[model samples]
Target: MTLELTPILTRLQNMLQGFLTAIPNILIGLIVFLLFVFISNLVRNAVHAIAERAGQPRGIALVFGRIASWAVLTLGLLVSLTIIIPTLTAASLFGALGVSGVAIGFAFKDIFQNLLAGLLILITRPFRIGDQIVSGNHEGTVEDIQVRATMLRTYDNRLVVIPNSELYTNRVVVNTALDKRRLSVNIGIGYGDDIAHAKEVILRELAQIDTVLKDPAPQVLVKELGDFSVNLDVRFWIDPPIRREANEAQDRVLETLKKALPAEGIDLPFPTQQVLFHDQTEETDGHRTRQREGWPSRGIERDPRPLREIRPNSEEVDNRS
Candidate 1:
């Protein structure tokens, strides 16, 4: 029995020897991986430097550089893996991954969409860092754009991170894109007041303000004739740098108008209803009496009696003729 076990041990030793001969392949795979990592790092640094020199924001540059570097490193890793294990060639790996890839993609669909949208935003550049923008219900200054989301600093100094997908699909209004913006305000005055004088006063107030542009000129139009007051639309052009000053300018303008109007004897009217009463007994024969003196009465009277009566037919004498 001892002699028979020796042959089986010899065969096991032969198999082990053959497997040990492939150890060099493992070392080569590790060397290739390290080389790829080094190359990827070098490329990433170079790209980051170029982007920085181009004046791109640090966050945006890092986003682009990291993405590019990782993409290259992933390809290198695949190659190394295939070399180590001959069964994992590109075609075979892709074919197998194709089935499971759909599942993984479905799980992270939103993330992928946001990533793509962010990339589109970086490329197209509809707005940039420090731009005041309003999208969906969010209004703020853009602080940075990442691979999956955009960061905004609100007026109240709160940080809001919004998904890039939503930002791309909705309407985006860039307030700072134009060199100038229009400021409009609706003001009301008493109906009987002089509109020309009111407009002149408004124009004068607007002219005194330093933020208001004089080239385009300020506009004053009578927008509507209200029941008790006249609506005046005041529109003025403002430079981009003066956006922060617009609110202050508006407040000052209103305050000035409020104080100036009364000095000029102009009245800012409020809503009011007037009612008139009449006495029916004071009416003459067929004429209705006026409700109030100098009220300028008009229209038909509300009388209930008939003006004349109709007579019955009497043709009996005509029938005999």
Candidate 2:
């Protein structure tokens, strides 16, 4: 019994000595990790400021900044781990990371896809905040751009959150991307009216309106020989491509054309039809006759009664005759 206890005490003493020897190294590793964390935060802030000054989006800049800081901190952690475990090498660490990356990719495939798409959008900037865009059936002004989603304010005052991946994959129409947009209004003139004269009157009216752009010049083209009248397309350009502005300009231009065309003897005609009355009675030949029944006209009306009085005995003459 005395020999067994002596062997156990000797082994315990050796283990205790090894533990004490490792304590300082563990302490140093912990201190190094803490220092790395502090430096990482500083790096994050610095990157954020630089990107912002260079005109990058706020949300995207922050993302890049955070990535930089985390990368630095991760390197520091690897260094500290090496200090604690002297056998650990950079190659081993990277090999472990590669294996873990596969697992992470499989686990969060959709999340990573959106993350990558969001980064691409921030860099390319196909549409920016405050831009009015239409994607799929959704249309609105962009409010915020985030890593996973984007926020929009619809015309009816509703908020919409769309996934970044969907937006990136789909077609987007940016309405206000240009400073000016062209709009067309169709008006019909009587077939009898002079085409060249009507176009002249339209150009005159367009020139009077200050909202219409003069650089592109207004155009009036004969679009169609419509059923009732000739259709003319009046196309004009306006500045500040906004929906409301375009509508208002259309209304103003229409009103101006309405008042000016007729005053200038340009007839804006409506549909008219010719009524032919068919006398189907067997007593008379199958012939169509014209009759004016509803209203009096400026000119004299034609007597509908036939020559020699179709009915000779309908009116009795005086017997003395």
Candidate 3:
């Protein structure tokens, strides 16, 4: 029993002495790491200020600062680890990490993809904060763009978080990409209304609106002839192409046109259909030239009587024959 206990006591004594001997190194490493953390924060602030001064966007500046801070922190961590273990060099540490990084990358593939996509988006400047965009089923003002997701504030005041990967891969429409955007409205007038007069009236009314742009000039084109009326497309340009401004401009244009067109004797006609009834016994039956409703007159003319009047006359003619 004494012999067996002796080895256990000896191993415990060795461990204690080793721990005491390494205490100073441990303290030194801790102090160095803490100092490096403080220095990294200072570096982050300096980089942020410099980027902003260089005219970078706020998000781009922030990301650059964060990258610098992380690099500093990573270097400090390696130095601290080397201090704690004299045998561990930065090269050896990196070599070990290289093997593990593949597993980590697979484990967090989506996270890293979003991070890469976000970085590209910031660099490309496809859309900026406060810009209105439509992506998939989500459309709103971009409030903030983060490494993993983009924050959107919908027109109805709802918040939506979309993954950056999705935004980068899918098609996104930036409504405010240009300084001015064109808006079109279709208005139909009766066939009898003068096309030239209607176009003049629409263009004149559009010119009066303040939101509409004057340089490109407004246009009213005859689109197509419909069953009841002719469709005229009214197209104009507006500045500061935002949703609210566009809607307001459209509302004003519609109101002005609705009132101005009818007041000027231009008729806004609804769908009208003339239905005809025919009797097989009538003399005009199967005669394309004589039919008043189906076909146009081709030098042959006939008075169209009521179905009751034509039916009895046709039957009497048939009896006589």
- Every candidate's lDDT: 0.79, 0.84, 0.88
**lDDT, residue 173, model 2:** 92
Candidate 3: clashing pairs of residues: none
- Cα lDDT tens digits, model 1, 1-321, are 355888889999988885686577677888898898999998888888989999986766778888878987997888788878866779998888898999999999999999999988887788888888988777888898888999988888899999999889888998888788888888899988999999999899889888788979999999999989999999988887334766776777788778888888889987999764333321222222323442334665545543222111223223333
Candidate 1: stretches off by over 4 Å: 1-45, 54-60, 72-98, 241-243, 277-296, 299-321
- TM-score of every model? 0.68, 0.62, 0.78
Better of 2 and 3 by lDDT: 3
Badly placed stretches (over 4 Å) of model 2 are 1-45, 57-104, 271-321
lDDT of 2 at 33: 94
Residue 27 of model 3 has an lDDT of 90
lDDT by residue for model 2 over 1-321, one digit each (tens)?
Answer: 445688789999999997898788789999999999999999999999999999887877877887799799998999999988878888998899898998989999988888888888888988888888898888888998877778988888899998899999988898888888999999999999999999999999999998899989999999999989999999999997777788899999999999999998989887888654423222122222332343334465445676236434313222212
What is the alpha-carbon lDDT for the whole of candidate 3?
A: 0.88
Q: Could you tally the backbone clashes for each prediction?
A: 0, 0, 0
Can you list the residue pairs that collide in candidate 2? none
TM-score result, candidate 1: 0.68
Which predicted model would earn the best TM-score? 3
lDDT of 1 at 145: 87
